[model samples]
Target: MSIHVVLYEPEIPANTGNIARTCAGTHSHLHLIHPLGFSTDDRMLKRAGCDYWPNVQIEHHDRFSDIPEKYPNAVFYFIETIGEKNVYDFDYSNPDADYFFVFGKETTGLPSELTDQFKEQCFRIPQTDLVRSLNLSNTAAIVVYEALRQQAFAPIAIKEAAD
Candidate 1:
């Protein structure tokens, strides 16, 4: 019944801070994959986060593989430009599931090694060809909120499944 927001090798501090704030508000756990561009205690990060850091459930990992190993039962959904599925295609309301939405670095989307291994799990927000991609913080908000929206009705879904 937990939702996780994974930031893979994230760069911008403000963006990470903003995403952290969103994670706090949604009650989602935040996972940061290392080789980060800035220190976690950066002034910009602290400022953008504005004390919400105290409320966020956060974890740090040296590698992305570490996460799957630690939470083997969790379902991972990677967000990439080359993904086959749209954001709305999946059902996030499964009561027994723990979900992780993985977002990549701002400058270079996700690593091919990851995208290749988890191609089926990758997803996109569905945009026109005119834009390369949306802002990192904004994209994180979109996917996280969508997951929350679906989970909001989990009681009905659970009841239906129990029938």
Candidate 2:
């Protein structure tokens, strides 16, 4: 199965870097949506990611809708603060179809319009108490592992899936 980690307008390069490293280690595809806060050449991200940035398989998308064109067979799963379905409840392991795990900007989360437009596409990562949400990279790490666990941690399936 193929997995795509989509970050919607991520603000912090370090967070993105860490997420990229996680994606590299897990062998998941990383997608960074447009209007990023920092440049791809940011020193902080470079430091946080070290040399792992090149190891990760990443794609850049100008818009969320562009994703479907790139992976027509994939399912888009957006993560947000308020979601009808708890992330834990969703079946990440289903191998019948490809999946894309979408996340929003760290500061304001996702745009309401996008969330409302894709209401059925939204999902939540379970949290407790006063915390609003987890760090972007951390959240990505958690969700990616769950997906990996479900897919038996397949080895770089993107190349084959795109074929």
Candidate 3:
């Protein structure tokens, strides 16, 4: 009943690290599909993620297709610029269902063949024509927050200020 952020062939260490930090804060699991651009121990990655690396739950996969096999019952949504539906249009309020947000690499997006196969599950963040695409980390945070909002930020939503 939690959210999972899946990065497909992410090429930038900083972006992945930042996303990992976001995942740690939101209590979401992170799935990284190879082949990764940088080693898991890269300094930039650690720096961007700060000291939150231990707080993040990360799983690495050798292939993208292996994700579905691992989480057969979870609902998956692929994020792409050419997606048919807007991210806000989807309902992420199911407390009993596990949701996975799949994003592409920094340079080239998810494979067209794969996206085409799951065309109905594809989603995109609205943007102006001024920019080609949003940054990978930014996009992941935006979508993750939206999903969290729809679910009323359950489990992680705090009402009282920390002392």
Candidate 4:
């Protein structure tokens, strides 16, 4: 199973860079929507991402509408704090469905109307009363790892015994 992460107007370059590294490590794809807070040419991101940026599969889109046309077969999932379904409750191991984990800007999330449009596709990470939410990159890591876990932590494998 492959994983795709969508960041809408990401605000921080460092965060985006770190997420890029994560995606590279996990063999996932990262998508950045237009009107980004920092230029994709920014040195900070490339520096933090450190030589792995090129290895990471990243795509840029002018708008949300542009994305759907390109990835018609992928399942788009909006991650928000108020989602009806917790991330844990969702089945992440469907080999047939390409999983897309979508996150909004750090300061303000996606327009409520947009989220409502895909209400059934929205999900949230469980949290305690003391915390409102997690950092965007951190949250992405959590969800991706969980999905990876469901896929049997694809990174690990048993070596065949030498005869």
Candidate 5:
């Protein structure tokens, strides 16, 4: 019933922190696959999350394969530059199942070996050569919001319960 954002071998602490903040705001879970470039307890990371750490549901894993083992039925969408389809191409209408959006590290994106296994599920955010790729946090936000939008923007507590 929730979305999961996976950062594969993330190299930057601030990016992860900012992503964590976004996840907290959207009620999504943040998954970090090691080995991270910076320690999770880093001060800069803490500063970037800006006191929202308590609100974010974070998980750590030693390997990416561990995620599939944990959630075998989870739907994964790999985010990489080589993906033939953009985010808008997919139908994320299933709100009952957990959607896992896998984003590569800030440096070198997800390995081709991994993407090859799930090429159909891979997606990219359109951009020009103005930069190598969009920022990690920015990309995550874009994909998550699109998925949420496709789902009618429901199931995320659009309104609080009335007494």
Candidate 6:
């Protein structure tokens, strides 16, 4: 099973689109929890995803609670700026496991109720107090890539250049 990227109440179409492109490149599934800040047909979103939109596997959800019912066997990790553990602390190398990386909206972030419930699985990409947080798309990319890297970048063929 592949990794899944879940965006809860994402507010920026462009960020979502960029994350979609990253998900496409990594072969990760994307789940969007409504209400979204923009329409799926938004031009900016389309432009950001570009030709990779078709390659991205996307799903929509009405609420955060709907996800567990859908992917019953999947293990979820809530991503936030103030998580208790670092992203690298998790062992994502289990080939048989399916992981879901849940991110919040561009502005308010994941609801306290949700994050608190999943406190054990909460992870953060370490950053200094110099800034409030990184951009949404950038954070997604960083976390997804870290997970991919831990898994040896499986399902994403990597070839070395010819000597």
Highest-scoring model, lDDT = 3
TM-score, candidate number 1: 0.89
Error of 5 at 49 (Å): 5.3
List residue ranges in candidate 3 displaced over 4 A: 42-49, 157-159
Per-residue lDDT value at 25 in model 1: 79
Candidate 4 runs further than 4 Å off: 42-49, 155-163
Q: What total of clashing residue pairs does each candidate reach? A: 0, 0, 0, 0, 0, 0
Native-to-model Cα distance after best TM-score fit, residue 155 in candidate 3, in Å? 2.9
Report the C-alpha lDDT of model 1 over 65-125, residue by residue, as the tens digit. Answer: 9999999999999999999999999999888999999999999999999999999999999
lDDT of 6 by residue, 18-64 (tens): 89999988899999999999888757555664778878899999998
Residue 12, candidate 6: alpha-carbon lDDT? 87
Residue 137 Cα positional deviation in candidate 4, in Å, after optimal superposition: 0.7
Which of candidates 4 and 5 reaches a greater lDDT?
5
Task: Please list the Cα RMSD from the true structure of every candidate, rounded to 1 decimal place.
Answer: 5.6, 5.5, 1.8, 3.0, 2.8, 1.6
Record all residue pairs in model 4 with backbone atoms less than 3 Å apart, i.e. clashing: none
Ranking by lDDT: 3, 6, 5, 1, 4, 2
- lDDT for model 3 comes to 0.91
Better lDDT candidate (2, 4): 4
**lDDT, candidate 3, 1-163, per-residue tens:** 8999999999988898889999999999999999999888757555564688888989999987798898888999999999989999999999898999999988999999879999999989999999989999999999999999998899486769889
- Record all residue pairs in model 6 with backbone atoms less than 3 Å apart, i.e. clashing: none
| Per-residue lDDT of model 2, residues 122-160, tens digit only | 888788858978888888888888877767776445445
Q: List model 5 lDDT by residue over 82-128, tens digit each.
A: 89999999888986789999999898999888899999999899999
Summed over model 4, clashes come to 0
The TM-scores, one per candidate, come to 0.89, 0.86, 0.93, 0.89, 0.91, 0.93
**What's the lDDT of the predicted structure labeled candidate 1?**
0.88
TM-score (C-alpha) between model 5 and the true structure = 0.91
1 against 3, candidate with superior lDDT:
3
Residue-level lDDT for 146 in candidate 4: 93
Error at 116, model 1, angstroms: 0.8
